[model samples]
Target: MELKKEFTDLEKSAVKLTVTVSQKDVAAAYAETLGTYVKQAQIPGFRKGHVPANILERKFGEGIKADTVSDIIDKALNEIFENDAEKANRPLPYAEPVMEKMPELDVAKDLSFSLTYDVYPKVDVKNFSGITIKEPQVTIGDKEIDEELKAVQERNAVVIDKKDDEKVEKDNIVTINYAELDENGNEIAGTKREDFVFTAGTDGTFYRIDDDVIGMKKGETKTITKTYAKDDKNESLAGTTKKISVTVTAIKIRNLPALDDELAQDVSEKYKTLDDLKKDIVKNMESAKARRIVEIKNNDLLSQLVEKNPFDIPSSMLNAELENRWYSMAQQFQTTPEQLEKMFSSAKQTKADILKEWAGASEKMLKSRIIVDNLIRARNISVTPEDVETRYKEIADRGGMSVDEVKKHYEDAKAKEYLIDDTKEQKLYDELYKEVKTVKGDAMSFADLFKGESN
Candidate 1:
């Protein structure tokens, strides 16, 4: 096997490997196959296991050649990675090599095939000594607790329709009639609509609700106009201005429950009193705050790391990330893209549109992930069996299943892949933390961070 790398445009590297399998080696490989077949042979004129070598050759000769060829190709690839463990730095093989033009075997010569692959640009990571990041001191103050209690109350609140004479305000849900249009005042191809429900908050369902829906009262009818973003998931209505005439049919407001023993029971059975619930909330907030600080510091260090160690990412990897992102978003919304567009006819997306929108960010994310993986490997960080088992158990418990049952359910290939990927990310985070200069921040509370910034 002869291997060489050639530099190409755009900081890419192409590796060309030539593999030669001599006739002698091929014959030896075929001989073992012939021997096995001969032992089980049953020819027309001979007893089982008594077939002649020449006869067997004439019968199974082509089959032996095919098997030999497959074995050689598999062996070549295995040797390529085994020859140098550092092949991980190479751009992962984007496409399998084409071998239709490979050399054919002759009576006494060798057969050969050429293999090609692309390599990602090299990244030299350094200069970690002077790095400093502010760890957003987290504190659980009384005000934060009060705000959290308010949120909890809201979550447990029941919504009731307001009286016809009552005025509508923020946090109230309003029913309206809306339609989207083009610049020419002609109704946009996909924007015509009748009645729609919209909340007054920044929830994704109500696009630009703050500017259009808030401050309006029940029984009031009004026309509101706004520009929709070009990349808005709605393919037809995107980049268009539309008129919405809303006749508020009814208004509904949240009615928070009192913070007492009943509220405590509503939140969780583990707590018996309001104070007990508050203590539990505080404990959860503290843990969450600590985690947020760690996450923020980690992201800061990684962003700096990417800048210090620059390298080109493979287009294939970037494409994969884009697809993963789309799938993730789809899962979050609980529907496929096609279904989403059909359901939210005004705010659905085409596959091509989604790809175009996510391509740039996906590419950057792919490059960053590559850097994180390489750094973790270079530092010799490892996730142990115990770590994996502990995580698996925790996941099983959260999923409401026994660990043994979870293991059995994930005994297949796809589940193992998910487990390994999850474990690798966890292990990589630990490796990164060790490399950075960490200063313990103040004990922060989750309530402070969880509250809406403006609120």
Candidate 2:
């Protein structure tokens, strides 16, 4: 169990650990390993478990040596890393310790091996305080409330099926099947869809082909070449023109309910009148606007902190983050990473190209993350029971749920831990804001500020 250890510094927060075991232990381990093989050996001209060590060596010496070396290294690493000591030197959870070189097992000499692994980079954040950030002022009033009300009314709209002979029209709900064609005007495999429904010019059919589907009656099909803008929201269709054959299957009219107190009551029991709904909408929108402002503040501060504090992100960390982004992009395209590769290949882009394009942003994200972690740890910021309770109450008040219900929703141990950690991080940032100067930037509306927010 006795060992000698040496730590050598490497680039990108990596450390080389050298572990040495005496010749006596190596000889003993070799003997023990040979004995295991001796018990199970079935060499010709020898009885089982009776094969001589020298003969076994001639047959399986290399295998025995490799196994002994692996066992020794595993034991050595376990004894060191399992001590819960030297938190800074610990390997990151996602990164495994890579051996610098595979050592040969020799009973005549001491066992010596080295490992290189990534740890968290030493974070010395600079200029994280006393920075001025622009705080956008967004107005949440009757206009915002009315927009939200309109959405709620839309959700409560009634859909009525039109006659079989009815033709698709603007603002009419239509169900259509569509497929993309290649240069030969043939339907490419895996491009066909059926039973797709959307409101023309409103909900937007597949690829926003509302205009192409209009004026077509049920069971009618037409092939049209549609060109998408360079900045189209759907990345797959952006800057590309494809032939789409759309067949309108059904048409319906959406009847929006009257915007009055009765409609408000039907939407939610908490709103007895239209005025009550408007008041609640205002309150919710204000809360959302405030949350969005805080997010903007945090992002601005983090961006500044990342620039002020420059450090190398461990390659493993950056690679992991880029991998996550790649998978996310694949998900956005509704395809697998393997397929995504082919798609990019067709465009003359390689995986390396995409990863190189994303590396800067990924590294910046990691740097900002490290800064947040270091600041919180240095400040000893944490969440108390009261903090969690207050958060639960706020959520319940906003969602029209009881405090008990909110608590029950987050009752899972992992969920509770996540809540606590999130609250703790927010608390650290809240204290950080005290040293920051917030200046009014520009007047914007709630919708513009929270454009992509789903909730």
Candidate 3:
């Protein structure tokens, strides 16, 4: 047997193997050794197992010969791989080798087959000292705490229809019967609602309500026209400009409880007074702010690191990450791919289009992960059994399940891989804190961080 190897790409190789059929191979009837006839052999025609080997071959010669050829090719390929493991470098059964052409053979000639595959790329870790980036400074302030508390109150606030003579004001709850028609004046399905709530001056809920509705009194009716964004959460009304006739049914305004001990008790029983709550809130707020600052810094630092040490990323992995991100977004928005595409039709962004655009981000994300993984391995990061157990228990507790149940849920290899990756990421962050320089900047409230970004 003779084998030849060729390099087709950085991680791809092709092997051509030629084997001369020996006299012993044919004499021993190697097809029998390959277990093809174990369950089908017969010594005679009287009983199934009574048929003779020569008779079996003569009757099924073509089929048996085909199986014999496959066996020979497989065995020869294994030999070729084992002989050239080191020469191939990073190695595994990468992919099914594409046979460009097969060698022609007769009873007296050698048989040959060509196989091709791709191996894992070899990764080299280097230049760890120069990676640098800017970290955004975030500070949770009294204003942020107040804003969050207000949001909590709003979540708990009740809405009711306004009285017949009541006038609508900013933040005053307004309920109405509304129907929207397209340019044809045909009533659009799903564009009509008998009950919809909008608070004036706050972002108009559902379709944007005009300022004219804000100052209107109850029992009044008006027809308004407006355009809704293509990305609106309401699927049926998005991306459509329609004339809507709305009748002011009633307005129920929210009156927040005074920010005092009562408010403190409403949030949690741990606080006896508003001052006590404020102290705890401020502490929690500061911790949250610090975490946000760390996260921003982390992203900036990693981005810089990736920029400095850029290399070719595996296209397959990048595409996988993009799909994963798209699925995540779809799940968060509580909509299907088709529904989202319909809602955002004007934008021409189907899920596939969005994912294609995100490919670069996905590549960068995976590059960052690769760097973090290298760092973990280089530092010989160790995750204690206790640490895993404690973390598992914490997650289980949050999920309202026992640790054993959580362990059972992670029985698959993929789950274990995720847990290990999480552990490594955490360790990398800790290591980064020690190596990276952090500059303090003027602290900004969480609201300031997200306000312009959200709108």
Candidate 4:
């Protein structure tokens, strides 16, 4: 079908597309639709295939005209969108074109309608190179090594049953049966659990009972009333006060392994001696610290770049980003969006409030992404076949899998495309890093560095 197209730019990265279909096209579409109905449509008091054209038209003329008009519009729009010459008028991937006006179906005359949609903003990145960024200089000290060694020892520790007279203390694993009680001290239905275990005095334990668990001997029963804060992690119990009855059934203590050659052997076969384990720990810590430093530098550089180059983002893209972030947060909390919304309802928090709190970070992330993508395109950054092979080898070595196996895992087209894109981004970052002047700043401890803090 032949079509005449006109484009109009609207505010906020929106565009209006007006398309007119010729009368000849509409007539052709109507005839094609009519022929199909005549050939297959059933009618009373007549042979199915022998229905008269006038009768069919009289019975279904309006329906045929509407379907034909819709078909013509769809065909014209598809042609305009798919044509390479019309790429400039295409909407952004996240934006769906909505019909602004629906013209009445008219087979005898030309048909025209307008569609409005958001498009990606044209970005021109400036001042992206030669910027000064601070790089954290981190070193693995003995204190870090000792802490890591202690963690390792703890991991290999054995759990031993506590003595009969022993009381629960910090780091002791206690198994208990618990139930929520009403004001009358009656156990609430469906609120009981048996063999619930947690370590005393640890954040992993329930906030209401973490401190209360301390000094409780085995077989002891206690009931306490606690009020949970509004921001409690347990959404169901948040901002509610309840009485909980707890009975400690068992207590166990962790016996940490001695920091010696025997412990090293138990930790890993690669380490035959304590010094070997320490050396490996130091190497791993240094590598992790180096990676963290590069990550911080990259984030800082991108943040600066985004700040220098600002543009209005499409609302659709921002909404998509926010949705992804919201879903991710809900997943972390083991809840659904509906459940989270309901939980917030009690606290008088609206969806707008949540969006307002997260919009700043989400917008920053999108700005950084757009800037990096534009820079990569401007510089013609690409990943070579050798880059893919090298990446495959690296992944294979890390996963203890064959290179062919790793390649097989990424045989899907999308996986390969993602790998290529990731490689290109890395190359772009490396080039930009060279252009930036980085100064070594104050040294950071392992704890601070791994915790994602920068000087």
Q: Would you estimate the TM-scores of all the predictions?
A: 0.65, 0.88, 0.63, 0.81
Positional deviation of residue 343's Cα in model 3 after best superposition, in angstroms: 3.7
Question: For candidate 2, what's the RMSD?
Answer: 3.0
Ranking by TM-score: 2, 4, 1, 3
Query: Can you write out model 2's per-residue Cα lDDT over 176-255, one digit (the tens) per residue?
Result: 88877778888765556678877887736546788777788988889989888989775556788878888888898878
Model number with the top TM-score? 2
Local distance difference test, each candidate: 0.66, 0.83, 0.63, 0.81
RMSD of each: 7.6, 3.0, 7.4, 4.4
Give model 4's clash tally: 0
lDDT of 3 by residue, 1-455 (tens): 44344444542222333344443443343545434464556555446555656676677766666666666667655665566554443233424455666544233434555555444333455655765555556656567777877775776566566677778888887778776555676655534566666677776644567465887887887778877678866544568675777888778877567777887887778778988877776766665566566666777777877876766654555656776676676565455645445534433345666776677767787787777766676778878777778779867855547899999977888997788678767777887777767666555657665443311
* Deviation (Å) of 334 in candidate 2: 4.3
In terms of TM-score, how similar is model 3 to the real structure? 0.63
Which tens-of-lDDT digit does each residue in 54-135 have in candidate 1? 9987887777667666766676567666756646434365534445364454436666776655565455567676666657
- Candidate 2 Cα outliers beyond 4 Å, as residue runs: 44-47, 93-97, 189-198, 202-207, 228-239, 332-335, 340-357, 452-455
Kindly report which residue stretches of model 4 are placed more than 4 angstroms away from their true locations once superposed: 83-94, 159-167, 173-199, 205-209, 216-252, 346-352, 393-415, 452-455
Which sequence of candidate numbers ranks them by lDDT, best first? Answer: 2, 4, 1, 3
Show model 1 residue runs off by greater than 4 Å. Answer: 1-14, 24-108, 118-127, 161-169, 174-179, 183-198, 201-203, 210-223, 228-240, 244-252, 327-360, 385-435, 438-455
Clashing pairs in 3: 42-49, 42-50, 42-51, 43-49, 43-50, 43-51, 44-50, 44-51, 162-250, 162-251
lDDT preference between candidates 3 and 4, better one: 4
- Structure candidate 2, residue pairs in collision: none
